[model samples]
Target chain A: MATWLLLTLAAAAADFQDQDKQGHPTRAVLLGGSGEAHWNAGASVGSPWTTVTVQRGLRGGWTPLAEVQAASFARWQPAVGVGKRWIDRRWRLTGEGTVGWTLQGDPIPFRGPAAELRVKGGRAVGRFAPYLHLGMRSSRTEDRVETVSGDILREEARWETTLTGALGTGFLLTDRVGIDIGLDLPWVHMPNPSIPGMHIGVQTGWGRNQ
Target chain B: MHTHGVSMVRTILPFAFLIACGPPPKGVDYRGTRLAVVDMHLHPGDWQQVPESTQGYLASRFPFPFGLRPEQVAEGVLTGEAILDQLDDAAVSAAILFAVYAPRTVGVATNELVLRERRADTSRLWGLASLPVDRWDESSEAALAALSEALDNPGMVGIKLAHAHMHFRMDDPAYFSIYDMAVAHDAPVYLHTGTSPFPGTRTEPEYTDPAYLEAAIATHPRVQFILGHMGYDFIDQRPGDADTAIDLAVRYDNVWLEPSALGSRGSDPTGTNLPLVLKKAKTAGVEARLIYGSDGPQSPGFAADYLERTLTALEAADYSVEEAQLILADNASSLFGIPTFKAEK
Candidate 1:
């Protein structure tokens, strides 16, 4: 998904530069990494799972972006997302949506689509521009455990989801390439029925467009 | 050299300045203030040899309330390093390592090996010897010899007797010989008064009842009697409390209680009933008789974390901080006749 997103965004950037009659994009490729949903399926036979994503930015804001990404963590799923960047002098806004599938693991097969909206602003340095981001995420799971031994032994599969808000900062390596690291906590419900808990994720990613 | 000396002076100056700037403090004997406590009940498992299947079997047959799963037991067994680490972290002075085994022919060698290993680490490990009561007729000599040798090893503290194995009452005239040996050696006898995880025993030792211990205590008043599990039965229809047992300890100064199974076993196996035991101890005025113990590896409730929580619970049970210190350290020292009872700094 990340690869495809990057390629599409790069193509869009080239077209926008040509249309501007500048021949050169004032914006470089935005290289950034992200953590996306591997699977969010709840405790049932078939629930959608989410993956964590990290990415790199290739250039400045204003060019559209798209990518296809395979997770190094969750073995059975892959994803693709596309979005456009609207850049103001010092501020950048990005919107993207992703779709993917997770293979069945002993108990559950997951399938789902997710959407992300992000806004970031920061001071730009020579090759190091640090920016903060805010975004929202949601996912579901389907899986459960039952007592095969007797009726009295009660075991249930759990399903959970969350609404999340994040505060993070990343540095751009150059006009087209840089790394972003951020921490996000889900305030919504967690699927594991044992305890009401929260998850914190740190994501990093990079990209390039000509 | 001059520049290096100046750099050293610069680094040292702040520390000296801080000390000089502080008010003069009261001189205190901090070394002897805190007691060094070592729990005697620990089961370190041999994960390499015990199969997961075996562990599963152990768990299913003896569930958490009865027994911990093999992995839990295995973890408890290998937990020596972790326990030592916690002890180091918690400032525990030493630990008396012991094991739990059923009364079977194979159990003899296993128990002996455990004792030998525990004895090897005399500096920190006080190996408690286990005896197979059923095999006493055949293995008594071997058991006696092994225990004598281990006790003679300078680190081996005392003898650990589990009632589940013997099935004979504490008052049984037969155990007198064993008591005689322990008394002769000036070694303490730690007895388990609890229900066995497995059935099938020779006599179903009724003497485990705290009431029965009176006769033995009366007769062997000089022999140190360490009542393991705090004289309470894990599955007793009529469990004895600290009040009944404290009478024994108060009557005979030789009598003591090692709270090994305090957090595990009993009807409320999760240790929900522990406060009751601690209460009875405090009420009975036997708080100092309680020692830090955990029937480990076999009992799921006896972990390092459990030990900490147990102490916290005891402290909360209105036990005086000093009494809690004694129960956690001084009591075990007095019972085992350890001279240097203070926590090592």
Candidate 2:
């Protein structure tokens, strides 16, 4: 459903703020990396996570993206998808959908396919862009079902879901270089439920066309 | 050369991190005592019969490298022998095998399985029977009958309930009859309090808080209420309802505090919560009411690790050797009527 919605938005939305007069996108490739650390209130830091992303703007307000995300200091999940962003002057809105695999989820209790949907809205004030994001993530892991005699009759699939809401501000130090910091509220599904976390990142790319 | 050495150090660090799988934990001193070290919480399940989600949770927490999961180790292995070996590794005297019926959360470890495993070393192993409450509305009587019969076995020492995992309210009177059965059979009721990290467990204060059980605890004066986890919310690492549990223990003779699973890295990775709870229990002067349980045999070295963690916390909490003995062995021995050396004479 998220993918379909993203596709519909991409098709219906026009790049009024991002396209040149010839109807070509002005934005280019972006490479971003982020590190997340839990807010343990000074005693000890909880689960540490990192993510790296690549994005390229497409025509009609669409952007194609791929990312690798590792979490809890040991688990890794990589996803790829497309997004649509709308801009009216300094105001921005984005919707994206991604699918990935739990490449390695030790200490996270899952292994297999996963997906996410994110919607972010932000407004720029000079060099800083403040944003609010809401995201929904779902993943699948497998288990064996056995009869009373202990024979594996079949493999059952268990799906786990969690939500994330974040508020962050982006700093554009230079025309093509930027930094981002965010406070993240992630609902971790397996083992434990959730924890407070924050993220810091740097990205290099073309400035958003306006 | 320095750059090459730095790269080598980086390569070795991740490998070291991934090697959380092996180098089996060595047994430690049981506080330099030979008193009966009874671990009252052990979930021994047949690998084939236990749910895969449970296996996943165990494997995820105890990260076995090269895809050799800890949950797979017990396959075709002797369940009882494996449990006894775990006890030996942890330097514990005996451990109770609990039959869990949490079909919604961790899956079921049937009473039959618990009985079958206890036969491996009846002298050193015990069983705690639980009723299957999934269909309790239709089969409460039959389930009670099965529970009654299981309790009749000499090895079945108590009743086990995880209301959070079992999807029941504490004040719900439909299950009050279980306490009546416990009173009649002279069995203590060991119930899970506070929060569980497992998926599908109810985390509401209604289910996880022991305050909801206050009325029941008051009414069932003849029934001993051993609150498990000492109200430690494992998922959140908070001292959940420990004050209420301590108050109950102080207010009523039948109420007891169990500190099982409070020492696990999942629950208290910094080793702070357990000491805090132990200090409070000490302040309340209910050291004798504190029973030791590991919630153990979770993974390869989890039992040993949890035991070591608990001991470290006890030391940090300023518990003496004798108090440690009470928490570790003597108290449970007295509660369950397990014959110690003095009793055997």
Model 2, stretches more than 4 Å misplaced? A1-210, B1-36, B48-54, B66-71, B74-78, B341-345
Say which candidate scores most in lDDT. 2
Residue-level error in angstroms, candidate 1, position A6: 5.4
Can you tell me the DockQ of model 2? Answer: 0.07
Q: Output the lDDT of residue B54, model 1.
A: 39
**Fnat for the candidates in order:** 0.00, 0.08
DockQ of 1: 0.05
lDDT (10s digit) by residue, model 2, range A1-210: 999988765543332222231111111211111111100000112234466766665556676678776655456778898777655334566788899987554323568899998887765554455778788889888966677699998998988776866676765554445566776666655444344666776655443332
Distance from true location, Cα of B119 in model 2, Å = 1.2
Q: Write the per-residue lDDT of candidate 1 for residues B239-281, one digit (tens) a residue.
A: 4554567677767888887766556533345555677777777
Question: Per-candidate TM vs. native?
Answer: 0.53, 0.59
Candidate 2 per-residue lDDT over residues B1-345, each given as its tens digit: 999999999999988886775333322354564344678888888655556565566555543231234445554233777888777666677888899888778788888889999998998899899998877789999999999999999889999998999999988888999999999899999999999988778999889999989988999999999999988887878897899999999999999999888877777878888889988999998877898888877655666777788788888888887787778777888888886522110
Pick by DockQ: which candidate is best?
2
Q: After best superposition, candidate 1 residue A182: deviation in angstroms?
A: 18
